[model samples]
Target: MEHVRPLPTYLAQRYHGWKATTFAENRAWYKRLADEGQRPRAMVISCCDSRVNVTSIFGADQGEFFIHRNIANLVPPYEPDGNQHGTSAAVEFAVTSLKVAHLIILGHSSCGGVAGCYDMCSGHAPDLEEKSSFVGRWMDLLRPGFERLPAEADETTRRRALEHEAVNVSLENLMTFPFVRSAVENGSLSLHGLWTDIGEGQLYSLGISGEGFAAV
Candidate 1:
């Protein structure tokens, strides 16, 4: 609490603006959501990138989707060793508690996390390679994806491939959770991988074959 601070001036002004306009206009809807709780049909796991706007991209209203954002949108393999796992906890709550039918791993272009992983794996980022770097350990989840890339690939191709693979790796890790696997096996849950080009605003979905991404 000592470290907490008041909202910045710009954010306070924006909040007042939204409160007077959007919130006031949708007062009844907001009340309904507060009273009835949320029943979102989908869960979106996206990156902690300011450029990627998940709700705006899907035209989703509040409570329409349960979303979780983390660096690179990566999901670590199910390791129920009793350690803290924020992403895993979100996935469990979404699937088991919320009963979301669809789980989406959303990746994007110019992902700093993916780029860091690439640099770390390629021995270009010594800082990230240090054992004490949380980012280094987290990005290790994408190392397999990095290894999957061709040695001859140029920078652009490698970065894009790793971004797509971040989605693939998350989808695979999602299945490793017992609850997630059960939900999928029972047909109660589904998984999807997606990537977007920030510059072009074009979306691409992972192919069913898991080999490539196609424009959506």
Candidate 2:
């Protein structure tokens, strides 16, 4: 109890403001949501980057999207070893319990996680190579993407390519889950990958051929 603290002053002020305005204006909607439970239409897996606002980008309101954010938005291959798999559990719940019709992997430009992965794979980041680094181990999931990059590509090109690859890798790894595969095969679920350039506020969608991303 001693370790627990109240919300910061700024956060508390913002929360109170939201309660007075947004919440008050939509009190009935919020109450309905609380009583009926959430029935989000889609599930979005995105990066933990503070700049990427999934709700604002889509103009989504409460209960519209079930979002799961992680480093670089990476999804590891299906590993049901009965361990603590937070992302996997989220996917399972979203697909199996919620029966979301769409599952989206959202990647973005200038992702720190992807950059760290690139450095680690290139052997420039020795600290990430250590066994004790959780980030290092997690970013290992993106190594294959790093391997797929063109050998002659410049640093800037490689950086952007890796960001797209993060989305591609996640989309591919999502299929490794039996539940997800089953849902897709049954035509109940559809998978999509997207990348956004933070600087330009431009979005690109993975092609049907899964070869490249195109401006959307």
TM-score of every candidate: 0.98, 0.98
Q: Can you write out model 1's per-residue Cα lDDT over 68-161, one digit (the tens) per residue?
A: 9999999999898999999999998999899999999999999999999999988999999999999999999999999899789898998889
In model 2, how large is the Cα lDDT of residue 137?
97
The true-versus-predicted C-alpha distance at residue 52 of model 2, in Å, is 0.7
Name the best candidate (by TM-score): 2
User: In order, how many clashes per candidate?
Assistant: 0, 0
In Å, residue 95's CA in model 1 sits off its true spot by 0.4
The number of clashing residue pairs in model 2 is 0
**C-alpha RMSD of candidate 2:** 0.8
